[model samples]
Every structure is written in C-alpha cells, then in structure tokens.
Target: MYFSIEPKTSKEDLFNFDEPYAALKKCIGLNEERLVVVFGLRRTGKTSLMKVVYNELDMPKIYIDAREIFPLTPLSTNQYLVSIFIEFARKYDIIKAILEHVSAVEFVLRAEGKEREAILSSILKNINAEMQKRKTHLVIFIDEAQLLKPTGADRLLAYIYDNLKHIQIVVAGSEIGILEEFAGQNKNASLFGRAKKQITLNRLRPEQSFLFLKKGFAQAKKQISEKELMAAITEIDGIVGWLSMYGWHYLKIGSKKALETIVKDGSKIIADELEAFLSYRGEARRRYLIMLRTLSIREMRWNELKRTLELEEKKKINDSHISNYIEALVNYGFIEKEGINYKLADPLLKRGLDFVKI
Candidate 1:
C-alpha cells in the first residue's frame, strides 16, 4: 500500500508526519476560523496529507483540484464556478433543485463579468443558508490552488471566508511563493491581512527514508539488502515520492535499473515543470538557468555564485539582479539556502537540468 504511487487517502498508508496529520484533522473538525494552507516541495506528500485528513473527517465537504478546472477565459471561469457550485449542491443533497435553477437561468454559457459574480455569490449564500438550516458546516478542500490565481478565484475564496460563517476553506500547493501570493500574503490582494494557519511538509531524514523503504518493501512481501537500501537512500535523498517509486520499481526490476529509471523518468517530469516555470519568466530565463546550472555542480555563497554568473555571461550583472534571481529560485522551491550558500533543493533536479535546453 505504501508503494502505491497515489495521493494517500487513508492514514494507514501514510508514513510519518503524525503531528501535521493530527493538527490538520483537529483544525477541520473544530471548524477553525482561519484558512488552512498546506505547503511543501512537489513530491513531499502535500496531496497525500490533504486527502488523508479529508477522508478521515465526517463532514459536508468537497475536494477540487484547481489544475483540472484551470480556466482559459471568462466563460470558462464561470463554468468552473458552476462546477464547484454543483458539486457543493450534490454534497449537500440539494443537487436536484440546484440543477433545476441552473438550467432555468442558463448561467453556464452566458454568464459573464458581474453577472457571473452575482450568480456565484447567490449560490454560496444559498448553500450557507442550507448549512445553517441543517446545523452543519461545509469544508472546501482545494488542491494546487495556485492554479486558480489567474482565474480570480482567490477573490471568490476571500468572499466565502468573509461572508459564510459555516464554510471553511483548506488549500494545498507545492509552489510556495505563488500559493502565498494567491492567498494574499502580498499587501495588495483580496485575502490580505486575513488570518491563516499554515502546515509545511519537509523531506524525510536519512533514517526515516531508510525505514520507509524497508517497511514499504516488507509490505510488498520482498526483501532488500541494507547496502542496497542505503544506496537508494543516498541517491534519492529523502523525497518520499522518489522513495516510493524506487520501492515499487525494485519489485519488478533490480536496484540499479530502478534508480536509473527514476533518474530518467523523474528528470523528464521535472524538465517539463521547469520549462513551464521558465515560460512565464521572459528574457531572464537564461540567467536563471545559468544560476541553477552553477548550483547544480555544488553549493555556493552569494559572492561565489555572482562571480560565476558574471563570468558565464561575460558581463557584470548587478548585485540586485543576482539577488532577485536567487530569491525567485528559493521562493519557487527549486533551491534552498544554508548558512551563506545556495543549492538545489532536490538532487534529481540536477539530472533534470541536463534535459533543459539553455
């Protein structure tokens, strides 16, 4: 079960993070006032934690992955809202009436601008009224919520948090910087100054990773040597996703082939993600790549990295420019700072870098 590479919905399949699991469960069960935000590196089990808590709690709730309904236009944005509204109605056992009203209004394909806003607001108000009548609460769990930024759905979340007394919102995202921005960690945003509870998932330690792999393999009814386990731990570090992948693959092939497959497959996935990240960062993409490539070789202090960047570019890049680049990388969870040095947050990103073209 541990080696099953899916977002775990059962606590038994989860490994460690007992404190986070307990805290999150209590927060939702008690209907905490503050919004709950779960943050972590991409494969550090944020989804698993969120889903596990959602499944354990007995409440009126709906979990939506914003990535699936990412909107491309105003019409699509309204459609997304209607989708959420319909899901909420279904969860509350009001879908029959809600669909009747939705069809009568023809809001799906026609609603736009203020009309869409009004319809969404009305839907939430109605849902809140139903919850009040039933003397219950509704929790909206959104995964990868940063994807909703451009759709202006954060403002909708802000409205729900402020007006609906019986509704609680929980969101999880791997992109820490963007997720914070979406949640109005910035000064000028809808959710600005709003109270929030945050839970961050970090990579496992060496011992934890070893035990995780050992236990996972045992559950699979296979045996692995300590030396082989140590090698996998050393290479994959502490990312649970990679550890699970290794364990799952080792059952079919041997250790060497599994590691190689991880590097090959994982790098491709990370490469596609890095490419997407860079697509939004105009002209400065090359500079970011140079910095990442330099750090990929080894960790470096500020001055050392700056000198390397300047040398590679054959031009004197300003201190502020270097600082911004490094800050962006750190914020995006691509790199981490220790003492006075910076390095890739995941070792696999180095192999990913090989696939990235300049």
Candidate 2:
C-alpha cells in the first residue's frame, strides 16, 4: 500500500524513482564496483530504494541496519558481529563450519576489541572463500552506515573491498557529509582512492508531489478535495516520508486531524534528532541552535545571519566560527544554501525548532 510506513520492498509501491531504481539495479547486477554509496537527505526514500533493489536482486545478500547497534560499545559491537556471522551461516547452512572455525559459539560472543574485529574479518574471509567456491557474489547492504563509524566498521569495509572480491558492500546514509567521511570520500581514510558507484535521491518537485498524493489517495480509495491536497502538499512539501505519514493518518482520522497530528508528531521527531546532534557538540551546541532557529524564521544571507547571531549574543562573533557553523548544519542536512541565503531544509523544521529549548 502507498501509505504503509515500512521501507518498500516492491517497485510497484515505490514512486517517481524510475531512473534511480533502474540504475541501481543495473549497478548491482553488473557487479562492476566493489562499493556503492546511496546518499540523500532524511525522508527522501533512501531506505526504500535500498530495500527494493535488495528484494529484486537474485544473489546472496545481507542487509544490516547499523542503527540497531548504536551507542556503540565493545560488547554491543561484539554481539553485532556474532549476529552477522550467525545470519550468514544459517543462510548458507554453514553453522557447523562456523562453529568449527571459531571452535565455540561462546568465544564468538565473548570476544571484544581487536580480538572481536579479527574474528569478524576472519568470518568475512571465510564467507568470501565460500562465495568464490560457489562462483557467486554476496551483496551486503549496510543502512545508515554513518552510525557505524564509531564501531570502526569502515576498516572492515575497506578490507572487504580490497581482499574479498566476491563480497560487495552497498551503504546508504541520510547524513550526506558524514556518510562520505565514513566511506573515505575524504583523504586519509581506509577506502580512499577506491572506485565506487554513487547514487543520490532527491525530494520531489511540486507537480510530482501533487501527483504522488493524488495517486496515493486513489490507491487507498479515499476522497480528498484538490484544495485540501494542495494545503497538505504546501505544509508537508516534497519529502515522501511526511507525505506517506500524512496520507496514512488521513485514512485513519480526517484531514484536519491528520495535518495537526503531522505537525505535532513531526516536530517532536525532528526536535529529538536535533537534540541528539547537539548532544556531543558542547559549547558549539548553542551556536548551532541559534543559527538554526534564526534560519527557521526565514532564509538569510551570510552577513545577515552573522549579524543576527551577534545581536542575540550582544557581542562579536568570529567570521570563521560563523562559516564553520553554517557548514556543519549544511553537512548534517539541517539547513541548505540557495544563492546567498541559507534556509531550513524541511518546512516542518521550523515548527520543530519551536519545540527545541534554546
């Protein structure tokens, strides 16, 4: 169904991504690249695209959601690695081999630090050998890969890309800059200077957004006025996640309640995300919030935003600091630059800023 909240597995339910879908399928099918990176802002359907391709592919595959292992610690990382090995072993009916390779299942679970990483590398090496013996490729999809940075999975990903030719890694992340950093798009990283297939998903245009809502409501067999649809489109804009949520809620409640609920629900969600982003920023957190809250009001040029921040602090702020702050926000997908002005990326973010304290 169009309004279903889960990541889409079927292409029939996906909308307006024909080019990307076809391109991704071809990229994975040809197996020309060791690494594929799918990049996009939040709610632009990166996960749905990944899931759909995963379902259609006719090869051995594994999908890992790194978000599940967040707040990464030695124990959690160890357990996650064991789980991956267990899944792979069960899929290939190689439980006996894995147990023999590790000597005991408990050792796999109890190992930590460098020992755990060595075990994971050994497991992948074994899987690669098995795939080579079978003469098949194993496609592994790691979603939200930016979260895996703390776990040092990038080194392992590099290892696979370098040595395990039969194992292909596809990673997707909503935080574009962070994902790139994790994937070695920057210098001095493990996978730097390697060939990679990159795909990006973007928000729908106004016309496309309207058509999406029209078709979605039609599929649901619900009646919604054109005027109401336009209002929802204006408020929600082009993000598919918000559009799907609004449609789902409209089917359950009425349009009025649905829109109200989206505001309440979306604001809290974005606020919580912003809070998480700020948690480790220390003194810079206040500056980020100020810049974000200011931009939430309206788009502003660099000088104007700096002036606003200065006024709020009643003191001078360095130009370099202002530049860094704007750059950080843009990298994190919170605000974007158009021409000389910077504005919040999502319409709902303005309302979300109201819920943020300071």
Candidate 3:
C-alpha cells in the first residue's frame, strides 16, 4: 500500500502527519459549520491528509480533486458551480432526480445569476435535510482546491456554509497557483471576514523520512539497508511523494539510474502542471521562467531578481511587475520566501526546473 503513489484515500496508505490528523478531527468536531483550509507545497501530502480526515469523520462526504478540473470558460461563476455539482453528482452516484430540477436546469438558465444560486441553494438544502434524516453530517471535501477559479466559487460556498446546518465544506489545496489568495483571505473575496481554520503541512523530519522509506520497503517485502534509506533522505530532502517515486522505480529497476529516472519522470509531471499555470500568464511567461530558473540553484533577493530580469529583457522593468510575478508563483506554492531570500518550494521541482530551460 505504501508503494502506491496516487493521492491516497485510505488510512493504511499514508505514512505520517499525526498533528494534522488530530487538528482536522478537532476542526470538524468543534465547529458546527466553518471553512477549514489545508494547504502545502506539491508532493507534500496535502491530498493524503485530506483523505485521512474524510475517512475518519462520521459523515456523508463528497471528495473532488480540483486538479482534474480546468479553469472557467464562457460561463458565469454560478454556472461553474452548477457544472462542478453536475460532475459531483455523476461521480458520487447521488440520485440525479433527488437533485430535483438540477438535471433540467440548462446552461442558458444558469447565466441568470440569482436564479442559479437559488437552484443550487435549494439542492443543497434538500441534501442537508436528507443527511440529517440519515443521522449523518455532510462534508464536501475539495482537494487541490487551488485549481478552482475564484470568480463566484467563494460566494456560493459562503452561501452553503451560512444556510445549511448539516453540511460543511472542507477544502485542501497546494500553494501552486492562486490558492492562498482565492481562500477568502482577500478582503474583496467572498467568504471574507468569516473565521477559517487553516492547517499547513511541512516536509517530513529527517528521522520520519527514513522511517517512511524503511517501512515502505518492508511492506513490499524488499530488503534495503538503513544506510541506503538515509542516503535517499539526504538526496531527496524529505518530500514524501518524491521519496515514494524513487522507491517505486528502485523496486522495479535495481540500479543507480533509477534515481536519475525519478528526476526525469518527476520533471515531466511537475513541468506539465507548471506549464498549465504558466499558460495563463500571457506575455509575462519569459520573466517568470527567468526567475524560476535563477532560483533553482540559489536563493535570491527581490532587487537582484529585478535587475537580472531587466538585463535579460533589455528594457526597464518596474518593481510592481517583478513583485507580481513572484507573488503569483508564491500563491500557487511553486516558490517560497524565507526572510529576504526566494527559492523554489519543491526540491523535485527545482530539479525539474533545470530542464525547463527558460
């Protein structure tokens, strides 16, 4: 089970995060209705932690991986909500007719904003009432919640939080793209001023990282020395997902190049996701790539990044431009700032960024 690399759902699959597991239980138990935001960098187990909470709680739940969702297009925010709900209903086997008129509500009707929210609100109320009749609470868990387009999502979710007594939505997302800002922390964003519970996952400690690999190999009935496990911890720097990838290939192909294979394979995965974020940036792609490539090897100061960009562009770049670019990357969880230095947040992504060749 530990050898499995997909977003884990069962308790038996995840390795660590005792603190976060407890925190999640308390949040759902204490708050009758509240927004709980769980976030971390890519490959850091935010999704797995969400699954642990989803499975632990005694409730009716719906889990959506927002990464599988694309951004909004040719629709109002309410339409986005309707579309996502439609997807949810289809995936979870929620009786379509129990949704009442949801199937009948056409896309044309959703564009009329007020009526659409009313429709959605009514469906949620019905679902909540059913949940109460069954003596179970409703938890709507959206993992990779950052990938959701902000537009009308917060306002609609805010409505559900306020109007439904038996239903609550808990969202988990990576820092990869706009997740931090979309989370209603912005005064202008919907769900603003409402109290929120946030739990951020950090990388595994050195000892825990070694144990994770040790236990994973043991589960596979493979023999790997403690020294080899420690060497891996040092090489990969304690990211659980990346470590799992290395362990997966190492088990399949017992050679030194398995390490190189992880890097090559990881870059393709991280780069594909990164490129999706980059696509929405328009003409600013060059500048962002420059910054990411530079930070791959060294931490940088704000001004230093600006000067480098200006020299490369052969044109004057303003403070706001540089700041905005970095802010976007930070929001998505691709880059992080500590003190005055800025650097890529994921070690595997840093290795992958080298191949990005900005």
What tens digits encode model 3's per-residue C-alpha lDDT throughout 1-358? 7766676777788888778887887877344546888877878888888887787776567777765545444244445556656665555456553566565457435446566667767667667666666666677888766556444666767777777767777887776446655667777767777777888888888988988888889988999877777767777777888888888888998636667787788878888778888877878987899888888879999998998889988999878889999998888778889899998777777766655544
Per-prediction TM-score to the true structure, in the order listed: 0.94, 0.94, 0.86
Residue 142 of candidate 3: its Cα lDDT? 81
Candidate order by TM-score, highest to lowest?
Answer: 1, 2, 3
Question: For model 2, how does the per-residue alpha-carbon lDDT over 181-294 read when each residue is reduced to its tens digit?
Answer: 888987877888888999989888999989998999999898889998899999989988899899999999989999999978998899888888888898988888999988
lDDT of each: 0.84, 0.85, 0.74
Candidate 3 Cα RMSD (Å) = 3.4
> Top model by lDDT, which number?
2
lDDT of 2: 0.85
Better of 1 and 3 by TM-score: 1
Tens-digit lDDT string for candidate 1 (1-358): 8886677888998999798898788788354555899988889999999888888778788888877774455567668767777777986687765555576347546766887787777777878778778888788899998878888888888998888977889999988888898888988778988998888898999999999999998898898899999998888799999888888888878888998888789888888888988988888999999999999889999999899989988999999998988888877788888898899988889999998887
- Report the lDDT of model 2 for residue 87: 81
- Sort every candidate by lDDT, greatest first: 2, 1, 3
Kindly report which residue pairs in candidate 2 clash with one another.
none
